[model samples]
Target: MAHRAASGWPGVTAALAGRLAKLDLYHPRDLLLHLPLRYEDETRLTPIAAAQPGFAAQVEGEVAACEVSLRPRRQLVVRVRDASGTLVARWLHFYPAQQKLLASGRRVRLFGEVRAGFFGAEMVHPRVRAVSAEDGLPEALTPVYPTTAGVAQTTLRRLIDHALASQPLEDHLPDDLRRTLGLPAFADALRLLHHPPPDVPASVLEDRQHPAWRRIKFEELLAQQISLRRAYLARRAKTAPAMAGSGRLVRALVDALPFALTGAQRRAWAEISADLALPHPMQRLLMGDVGSGKTIVAALAMLQAVDAGWQAALMAPTEILAEQHWQKLAAWLAPLGLEVAWLSGSRAKRARAAELARLASGELRLVVGTHALIEDPVMLPRLGLAVVDEQHRFGVRQRLALREKGGAGAISPHLLMMSATPIPRTLAMSHYADLDVSVLDELPPGRSPVRTKLVSEARRDEVIARLRAACLAGRQAYWVCPLIEESETLQLQAAQKTYAALCEALPELRIGLLHGRLKAADKSATMAAFAAGELHLLVATTVIEVGVDVPNASLMVIEHAERFGLAQLHQLRGRVGRGSAESVCILLYAQPLSPAGRARLKVIYEHSDGFAIAREDLRIRGPGEFVGARQSGLPLLRYADLEADADLLEAARQVADTLLRDHPSAAAALMARWLGGREGLLRA
Candidate 1:
């Protein structure tokens, strides 16, 4: 029976379809693209004497003896013999049917890794199938596919083979382009990948270095580039308010700053300003190292919107960071006769209502808050710009909701995303291709360099002593713990326990505690006390990893630092070193460090550059985890390795632009095949 690409298999039952859904196989076309994770060789057989231990080989023999042995455990043991020698096959866990299949005098073919067992050479739970002497060896290696729990490898292979036979495998790229790029034909590549010849070097295919693999990777990347580039073009076609604000507010804020803007900051602002003045909605990402003065640039951009008689809003991921931004922006703008409203979930009901009312009426042009800003009650009728701080901390839908707040009567607000975590180049090229990027590479003048030290848990006492010394000398310090509460499984230090211990260790110094569970009022009081120099030391969790900044706080001690990620460690260290005084970050790690833990700590200790540390983090954790692909709403590359296939990525990028401009139909077809309607998520 003929099966359509979207109709799925003809005889698949509901139960079978449910299992296929778990592997994301909804139609026949999906099975065609379900490439093998690895392949097993079964094209030839080896004699018992020629079989090598620790290597997988196919061997044929007749079962001389079969028995259920209970000596070591319940198992099925079968002894097979050939003209050359004898081999034993054992199954620790077996069924009655399997035992009958291996009955005495039956000819069988075994495929598995041979091992040196106590009795003799053995194969553990190998693929045992009854065969006749007339049966011939296969012509090609068998394909093994990634399958779900209910779906067996053999079942998947059968379904995919059927799809390959039924589905149309046509090349979308023009012939000249494919030949110029030295890529193989589309149909040939898929057929070869599914059933490779016996002579093919397994290493090249396994490592994805073969020509067929290249074609697959290139096509996958091309689809991604086309999706992002098309999203960019689609966004430009939409209309937005042209926020060409007079330079009055921008100049006043710039002149009022204590220090001049760095060259990198100036360049970033110029690019942003130019985008804001355009008729199309601006989607730009402002990336800077920790403590590189990103907030001021955001303030200037917001003022540009306000100067054009439009409302502006900023959203942060957490309450603490939002409050920090609100405080700073208020302090900077209040002196210039502008009122900034703060909105948060924990605010008093009456106060939140008042802010929401003002926002909806356009009386409040500038507001900063957490996710509460995106709630249904809050509205910004004339919002011309929306800025999201630490944008990766938010999910795609949250950011989209904030943008929709300004979508009134065919007018959409421009968006500016700010991230303290530096994105590596390869990631920026693939994941963030839809957004224009501006980087603030320079730190402001007078920012002291922070010295990082790695200390073993045995030296905890020394680190505490150093902390006490620094605090007694009128310098504040932060003690960062990994968990807010006790976790018996992790055994890491908790903030409350560390707070009580530090208070007992140093009675003369005033200390404070902060964590996420605390009430909003209490958290604010504790943070305020620490920032105002009322507390000499503060014990906190990773809640303070990003926005809490105090110049007087010149020392930081991170307990169980090995448990923290590279980006978190860097942000926590940035809390200090804001003042002229020399700052030092002490990483207190436990014993028996893992290899990955050691690598992370080493990267943080050796490099103070955020970009350099980010590159290393990408290498260690890969692009998906490093940038939070789920939060960004961008599908990751399934076949292409950003580092290994960078050349192919560049080639795909160039081809994507050409396809979009000259061959729009081909571009759309490619996106449909690979992305499968998931490209809509990139609109946000």
Candidate 2:
């Protein structure tokens, strides 16, 4: 706790040495946002006679003897005497110096798994420690915190305790404000949330239902809404020339359409056209669940940009997707006399140089590539539109990186982002507040629903045999593996091993393997083979979840399906049923599935609605790992759950909108100061 120099932390300061401390908070906002992972209130003190396997209990015993061993791993065995008998206390993965402590013969508290050994009752590799008389952990319901490598749970608890006890408390609601809102002071609210008694007040326990919570939710929402409104209004000042699609470009493509554009596609088309008519740069999110035909929407958008006599670009996250998009668009658009170019890591140096020169010379109409598109050296003569696929994977930095490639010119190119992942309302406000959203909720008519079934590992072989039969009948199937490779410690399962076994079991069928480690060219090659009927069954990692279309692939066999998230499973299922085939998705799970996993499977089995799955996914998993911190770049909320504070978000948006509209300079000043910056200094 002593204030001193911390490595690479020059400006940071710490509390005094003797001060009770809060956990070394990783993210200041996280403390406020660190919603509970799970609450454990199942602990019960048990006598030595009643100690048994599969139970979490608190036990006190007299220290009888202590010894050390190093047979498997370094260990210290402490013999403790209970009322019924003596028990061996096992501790593993400790300092070698701890041997001196074992000889001291001191009583200690033990926690972890309790298993009956060959000779007697024992705690195998139990997490043990000396208990302090005034330890802060609750006797019945201790909260286990997440920590970094050097940070222990105990250390985190201490820091949190200090923060709770000594930090300057904010009375968010003063006496006057409290009376107006019928709310308690900020300190009281924090205490109520962090250390509530058993008989918690109804208001504190269910903040979602509380009037104060509604006020807060409104505050958050209003701020976001206001900010977006300001940006939107400012952008509206400029006018864009509408380049309506003429049959000159669409005639060849329309004639080539094997299938007519769905009604939903037409709606999306109209929406994009309206955005193009505006003078301002288009900043819109094309949100469509998997198989909702967003790709066609993008193609139409690109054609409009090309029609304006301005070059357009499409950026993808990986080479596989980039190439896939290039081929599909090229087949349709190129036949209409539109020139297209491809660039990625796999492209040869000379070929890349040619593409770059073409881009710089304004010869290429549309180009597709991975992060390679955003390379600083790349030149775009007149970039009219930039369409990003799987928009969630690319964050602010990646998008900014691409924007720079348009050059230090008079104006930045328009942006059209497409995402299959359906974000919930709460998340849309906090995460994508800047971008306007358009949802492709309707599917093309006559698209048959995919039949989904949940099968256990015991039936895995049967499922595989069924897939073999289907493939033999000249049908294609996807065999998805869980992990990239095997691990000795997971105790779970792996995909590569499964792939090898399936290859051996189905020798007559063409089997292909695809995972992350493979080079982009190789992965794309395998995928092309599967699409072209060279491979009947594909054994792959989750690399194909985003947008690898194979209409002939009528069966999706996702092994160890319980391990994947709901959104991901839906995307994989989408890879099939794209063609005229009546597709079936088989989810193979291991025995004794977790309740949460069961719920996930049940939702998918009973329904195939992507948006519903997404909402439930958000509700079940909370916010974390849903959009993911890395992808959304949203700060975790501790005291505020976006889900719980929807009203606050709406209110915050309104305030931001009004302030910015009426007084831009003043609003910017307030934002700069609030963000810890001098007025007119920070651009954002």
Candidate 3:
């Protein structure tokens, strides 16, 4: 087949080409990949009398009468009659050209939702296409596409038809592979999914489980798997100075800690230690429950690097978290004579310069900072280990940049990405496929579980009384509102208003307000006051969800808790219960909760395990909304449903591995077809 110029197509004008460009469809191959959203069964026509009300119906009939009426707010009414009965197609707004097309005696096909109106069996503004005597009706379902504002469905279809007719598509899937999977050829699959033969059941096409769709989906999943595998290979190809440690610093730190390490913590630390000792830079993810002492494991890894005469740096997402880590690390390491330096956006210029200088000289054995550590000026010449805390908050590029901080020649800094949010096994396997994973599944000892309860807004007074009593008992509490300020769209309480209300309700107790809109200094002061037990109650927003760790704050009252995701609710609840004192998390939800909201609250209330909550979140909110997917830049799966296509995904992974091993060239072609320009980035 010879290719045809898209501009030479019957309906494709320069303007149409420009519009198609907006859709990123340039070459014939791009147009071929533009799969339809759905197909409408227009092959068989429904008689006017048999048309179901409020259901889409397609009918072909000769126009018996056509006229524009001014009485009913100026509508063009076309009456068409077939063998069964007559139906009226009404359009409230129409151009004079449309009236010329709708003249009487003209055969036309009408498709739209039929409804009972003043005129019985009427279709309001139905899709109207003229039918000629020589025109043959389509023998298969009509494809409905996602189009831009300027491009119409008919014009798009014509352009696609031209492209398909002229372009010769090469099937990239190996013949054996296709036969083993029971899949159609690449070109054949494209044609089947686009046109879809009349014999193909509508339900199968709708679910996108037809052989054609599955084949395309497998190709996509294979591309992703291939890219991830290539990334792992590429990173491993580079040389990294082996961080073999004498276990001196690690042993000393473990002995110095007040509490003994849990079995899970010890295992996770062992894994990290082993990875760091490898010749290749360690690309690993450390996931743990909210209070699961992942920090200790990270500390052990950093200390191991320091023991090997290499510098280590830890980067956090927020300045508060960076400062929090610095405070804890400085307190722990200062006594051991290991210098720790801090850098953040809020750090003074002089202090930041000093820290950078110290890092460059390798005088700073352990460095803690926010994104400032990744900036060009802040160089760590001997950086052997780079720890990214709350890894989900940073992008892929940021993580790679931190890895490039040190190591001469091709060597790169070892990376240990840490997250307090526990990820479900399914998500971890797919999203973190390229990296090794270590999970800290157990919490530290003496950390009691936070008792969760749901409270109603109707009992606001009782809740206020309880909070006041809790405060008066020499304990601190947190009142978390969903919004920083009053939102006109939402009826949830604002942090500012809630703070004022709490002050008035409990005049004897000290209260502080914290939200994102507050100045950095003010926010830090408020958090400091709350942490020092100066403020009995702290009214805040979700900003405190991750880093504001006050152990004395035993009671957490989350207002309008229904609006938060399961992970967020769990994190907010984690802020409390850090102390030995008994802690309670009170979820105050608005009445008449939606099904999803009710389910989220119930999951949070019943389950204390972050991993279980993560799985439940994956089930309720789905893959797209899952924290792992949203944060990890997981490739968008067009036909592969994360839940329904789990088995297919596994098969694709195996196939990808085999193809890459046996036929590298074929794997490359597959990656080119699916990943396009993104293939290079994945290699990076």
Which numbered prediction scores highest in TM-score against the true structure? 1
Weakest lDDT window of 10 consecutive positions for candidate 1? 484-493
Steric clashes per prediction: 0, 42, 0
Q: Which parts of model 1 have CA positions greater than 4 angstroms off?
A: 1-8, 484-493
Selected candidate, larger TM-score, 1 vs 2: 1
Across 1-684, the per-residue lDDT of candidate 3 in tens digits comes to 122235654556787777887776756666777889888888878989999998898998999999989984889999999999999999998999889989999999999999998878999999999997677778878998889989999888887888789877777778988898888898989998889877998789888888898888878888888888888988898777699889988888889999899999999888888888999888888998888887778888999999998889999998778878888888778777887898877777897888788888777778998888888998788888899999878876777788788845567888898887787776665666788899888888778789999999899899999998999999999988874234633423366677888888899999998776667678778888889989999887777888777888899999989988898899899998898999999999998999999999999988999989989998997776775444455555555766677777788779878888998998898776665554444412
Off by over 4 Å in 3: 1-14, 407-409, 484-493, 517-522, 591-596, 620-622, 627-634
Listed per candidate, the RMSD to the true structure in angstroms reads 2.5, 8.0, 3.4
Error of 1 at 208 (Å): 0.4
Residue-level lDDT for 79 in candidate 1: 93
Quantify how close model 2 is to the true structure by its C-alpha RMSD in Å: 8.0
Please provide, for model 2 over 1-684, each residue's C-alpha lDDT reduced to its tens digit, 9 standing for 90 to 100.
122222332222444221212333333322432323323332444566677777655565667887777877667777766677767777776566555554545655666556787658788766556654454445334445555555555665555555566556543222553465455555555444444444444344454544434443443344334445655665556444455546356545656778788777777778887887566778788988888888878888888878877778899997778888999898888678887789897788998998899898888878988989987668986787888898778876787667556652756667788889888887777656777788888876656678998888898779989999999988899988874334532312455677779989899998998877777778878988998999999887777887798878899999888888898889999988887778899999997889998998888887688888888898888876786656554434434577656656655665575566565664554332222111111001
lDDT score at residue 242, model 1, on the 0-100 scale = 94
